[model samples]
Target: MAAPITAALLIIGDEILSGRTKDKNIGYIAEYLTGVGIDLCEVRIVPDVEDEIVAALNSLRQRYTYLFTTGGIGPTHDDITADAVARAFGVGIDHDPRAVAMLRERYQPHELNEARLRMARIPDGADLIENPISKAPGFKIGNVFVMAGVPAIMQSMLDTIAPTLQTGARMLAETIEAEGLAEGNYAAGLADIASAHPGVSIGSYPSFSTSGFRNQIVVRGRDPVAVARAVAAVQDLLHRLKSDGVPH
Candidate 1:
C-alpha cells in the first residue's frame, strides 16, 4: 500500500480558547478528510495572537502533508491568521486583486470600508479558495490552507479544495456490535487478536445509558481482507467469552 497522505488542523481564535465561541470545524474536517482518503493526524486550537498562530503553523506545516487553519481570517482587528501565515512562510502579505474582486461581488464600493477590505489580504503566491457564501476567499500557500471560522464557509472552502488534494489508500472498517458484552470481558482477547492481525487496528467503544453498557468493536485497515480477518477474530472472541459465562 502507498504511504497515507496526512493532514493537521490548526483552529485559530481567542473565542474558542476562551470558551466564548464553540468549535464546529474539527469533527467536520476530520470526517471530511477520512472520506476523501486523507488521514487527519493532529489538531491544534490556538489563540488569535500572531506569534501563537505562526508558531503552530510552522510546526504543523512541516510535519504533515497539508495543514488546514480555520478562524482569524475575518475583517475584525483580531483576525490575524493571514499575517501569521505570511510570517511563517517568510512571504509578504498584501491585498490581492483577485480577493478584492471577490469581496467586491458581495460589498458595494461605498460599503467596502477599510475593516472589510482586510478580508482581501492574501499571502504572496497563494491560490485563492473560493467562498460562495460570503465572497471572502480563503488561500493556500505551500501546503497550508487558511479558511474562515464559520462552519458553513469552511465547509464550502473544503469542497473547493477537495479536488486539488492528493488522496491515498481508502481505509476500510467493520463494526461488530457486542451489545450484551462488556468491554472488560473482551479487552485481553481483543488485544491478542489485534496483535495477531498486525495490519488491522481494533478498538473497543462502550457507551452507557439507562439500560446499561452498549459495546462495539471496530476493526479498521486499508486492506479489506485484513479488516475482515480481524473482525472475525473479534466475533469469535466474543462468542467464547459468552460460552465461558463471562459477565455481561
Candidate 2:
C-alpha cells in the first residue's frame, strides 16, 4: 500500500492570536483534508512577523506532503505572507502578470493603487490558484499553498487546489458511546486494546452536560477490518466492566 498522504496547516495573522478575530478555518480544513484521504497531522498559528512565518513555512512544508497556509495575504501593510513565502523558498517575488490580470477583472486601473497591487505579488515559479469569489489569486510554490485569510476565499481556494493533490487510502472510523460511563474506569482496558491493534488509533473523549457525564470511544484506521476488530475489542471490554458492576 502507498504511504498515507500527510499535510500541515499554518494559520497566519495577529488577529487570530489576539482573539480579535475568531478562527473558523482550521476545523473546516481538517475535515476537508480527511475526506480527500489526506491526513492533517499538525497546525501552527503564527503572527504577521515575516521571520516567524518563514520559519514555520520552512518546517511544515518539508515535514509533510503539503503545507496549507491561511491569512496574511491581503491589501493591508500587515499582509506579509507572500514575502515570507518567497524568502522561505529563496526565490524572487514580484508582481505577476497573471495575478494582476485576475485582479484587473475586479478593480479598474484607477482603483488598483499600490496597496491594492500588493495582492498581485507572487513568488517566482509559483502557479496561481484561482479564486472564484474574489478576483485576487493565491499561489502554490513547491509543496506550500498560500491562501487568503478570509474563510470564504480560503475555502474557495481549497476547492480549486483539491483536484491537483495526490490522495491516499481513506481513513475509516467507528464511534462507540459508553453511556453513563467515566473515562477513568475504561482507560486501562482501552490502552490494552490500542496496544493490541497497532494499525488502529483509539481515543476516548469525555463530556459533561446538565444531564450527566458521557464518554465516547472513537477508532480510526485505514483498514476497515482492523477498525472493526478494535471496535469489537472496545465493546467487549465495556461489557466486562459492566458485568463487574463497575460504576459508570
* Best model per lDDT: 2
- Tens-place lDDT digits, model 1, residues 197-239: 9998899988888988899899989999888888888989888
Give per-candidate clash totals: 0, 1
Question: Would you estimate the TM-scores of all the predictions?
Answer: 0.98, 0.98
Estimate the overall C-alpha local distance difference test score of candidate 2. 0.94
**Candidate 2 residue-wise lDDT, 2-110, digit = tens:** 8999999999999999999999999999999999999999999999999999999999999999999999889999999999999999999999999999999999899
Off by over 4 Å in 2: none
Off by over 4 Å in 1: none
TM-score of model 2 vs. true structure: 0.98
